[model samples]
Target chain A: MFNAIVSAGTLGTALDSVSVLVEECKIHLNDDGIAIRAVDPANVGMVDLTLSEAAFESYEADGGVIGVNLSRLQDIAGMASSDDLVHLELDEETRKLHISIDGLEYTLALIDPDSIRQEPDIPDLDLPATIVLEGRDIDRAVTAADMVSDHIALGVNEDDEQFYVDAEGDTDDVHFELDRDDLIDLTAGPAHSLYSLDYLKDMNKAIPSNAEVTLDLGEEFPVKFHFDIAEAEGSVTFMLAPRIQSD
Target chain B: MFNAIVSAGTLGTALDSVSVLVEECKIHLNDDGIAIRAVDPANVGMVDLTLSEAAFESYEADGGVIGVNLSRLQDIAGMASSDDLVHLELDEETRKLHISIDGLEYTLALIDPDSIRQEPDIPDLDLPATIVLEGRDIDRAVTAADMVSDHIALGVNEDDEQFYVDAEGDTDDVHFELDRDDLIDLTAGPAHSLYSLDYLKDMNKAIPSNAEVTLDLGEEFPVKFHFDIAEAEGSVTFMLAPRIQSD
Candidate 1:
């Protein structure tokens, strides 16, 4: 059994972070909090999220896993204002989630966890470089790159101690860079990879503009983005495969 | 030659008011200001607009009419903020309009005035009931009615001295009324007519929510909406033919 009250914005952002990669997700609830892990059909992107009990205004739960359609949940959450509190309750008998905000009550049928794809193992990679910056900065870079090309290159110039995003289109190219002076934090190293902008653009939407996002990068390797949500009570990490660059 | 500088919002709103009914318009310029009269292709709606010299920051003209694509002009105007000043210069030799906002300049080719549809004469009608209300109130009623039906009935109750908007759908109906106590002004008469919601929805988007709109209604006659724009320096009147109600 799981019952909790959380801010609408928190749940909405968490759902959006995972829905971009998968339509459905198996959310594991325990006395401590909730955890979700899923991967896209193409296996090009993956998301792992955690929401501690501190994220909710009131919480009570016995460890269990429930499957839900992310899009439907997002839509219901969209009906509430960001500051509004949303109450969620699980009905074990009917296996449906009860969501209430203000005076409106919505019932969402749950999907069987057994019907969903098995969660993939999170790979551990020793990335050489780490950079932290405001979400808006990264979102702005992704938006600019999307306008110029289908793929964008992210790299760190160890010598210059700067992180840069670059894209090349048929007729135009875009280059944006920010040095240590502008970034929240940066660990200089030889890290560069090309990634599809389509996935990055979707992921960027879920990132709050004011939040500080930590990005892990390696040469020709997938990149990992980590950010806190729900006032630091929850966190989400997104991993995206790099597109091979032809010399 | 005509050269003028006006607020982006004023120009955008003016263009939108006419574009909802027609794609292209013949703008007549004179020493006093500009005048535009356009009728939709089906003659279901008509727009009469006037922008005086007081509406612009700077004005100069030799009196000429230029045909322009309203959509294209709106697009350029949209690029600027409401407070930003936009400069417009007519190039008679090239038959093009040069628009400059901030540092960006856009050139739009003019269409031949003679090739466009002729403007129709404004009909003077005697309407018994006149109601003045906030634009937001009208917009809200129209929006709610749109959700339940394709057409809406607008009328005034003589005994109650109230204005009302009603819509009946196959399964649901919406009725909204505002008596003299709630409205800015109302002159009640036996006035009632049904109108297509599709057109009202488009016209509502151009009306500023805070502006006072004067609505003139007559039994089985066109409804006329009048509102001031550009800080009273300009005004727009829209006339929509009523849809005959079936027994």
Candidate 2:
């Protein structure tokens, strides 16, 4: 059983993060908080999200797992104003989730958790570089890259102590760089990697423009993006597999 | 030949006012100003627009008529910010309109004015009722009415001295009323008419929310909407034929 009340903005952001990768996800509910881990069907990207009890106005839960359709939740959330208080309650007997906001009520049928794909184990990676910047900075870079190519290269120049994004098209290219002075923080290391712009574009939508986002990278390896939500009460991390370059 | 410089916002508004009725229009240019009159193919709606020399930052013209593809002009206008200055020059030798904004330049081939549809003669109507209100007020009414039906009735109640918009759908109805206190001005007359919402919706997009719009109506007659553009230096009038109600 689980019940909680949260601001629409917080709920929308959390749902958007997971929904970008998967339409359906298994939500793990516990006395301490809620957790969701999902990967896109193509296996190109994955998202791990956790919302602590502190993220909610009120919360109560007995450890359990439930499958939910993220798209449906997004629609209901779309009806609410950012500041509106959203109340959610799960009915164990009926296997449905009850949602209420400003007198409007909706009962969303939940899927059996056992039917969902098994959650994968989170891999342990010791990346060599770390960079922190405002979400909008990276979002803008991703947008510019999309205009030039389907994939973008992200790296750090150790000598210059700078992070850069580069996209090369058939005849055109785009390059963006942010030095230590421009970034919140930077750890220059061997961090050159290429990733698909499609996945990055989708993930960027979930990040609030003003939020500080951390990126961890390694040569030709997956890039990890981490950002706090709900005033740092909750957090989300996205991992995107790199595209091997061909000569 | 014609040469002019105007703010993107003023030019965009002028083009939008005419483009909504016809995709191709004959622009009549003279030393004093510019004028356009066009009717939709279905003859259900008509637009008359005028922009004086005062509307532009710089203006010069020799009396001439040029046919233009509005959709192309709109695309060029879309590239400019509302406050940006847009330059237009007619290259008589090439019969092209040279448009430049913020260093970006485009030359649009002009259509032969003789090849386009002949201009329509605007009918003179003696509508008895006159009402003036904020563009947003009517826009809201139109939006609400759209939710209920395809056609909306616009009328002024002589006894109540109020103007109202009403729509009836298969299962629901919407009604909005504004008396003298709620309007900028009102002159009651026998003015009850039904009009297609499709036309009003398109016309509403060109009306600035803060603009003071004047409406002239009569019993079962076409309704005329008049509003100023370019800070009163230009004006647009839209006339829509009423959908006769069959009892």
Measured on C-alpha atoms, candidate 2 has an lDDT of 0.90
Runs in model 1 deviating more than 4 A are B1-247
lDDT of 2 at B231: 91
Clashing pairs in 2: none
Error of 1 at B4 (Å): 25
Q: What are the RMSD figures for all models against the true structure?
A: 9.0, 8.9
Q: For every model shown, what is its TM-score relative to the native structure?
A: 0.54, 0.55
Candidate 2's displacement at residue A38, Å, is 0.4
How close to the true structure is residue B137 of candidate 1, measured as C-alpha lDDT? 98
Which tens-of-lDDT digit does each residue in B18-98 have in candidate 1?
A: 998999999998888999999998888899999999999999987899999887788667756799998999988988787
Q: Which candidate is the best by TM-score?
A: 2
lDDT tens digits, residues B1-247, model 2? 8999999988889999998888999998889889999999999999999999999999999998898989778766766679999898898997878777653445677899998888888788999999999999988999999998999999999999999999999999999999999999999999999999999999998889999999999999999999999999999999999998997
The CAPRI class of candidate 1 is: incorrect
TM-score of chain B of each: 0.97, 0.98
In model 2, what is the error at residue A192, expressed in angstroms?
Answer: 0.9
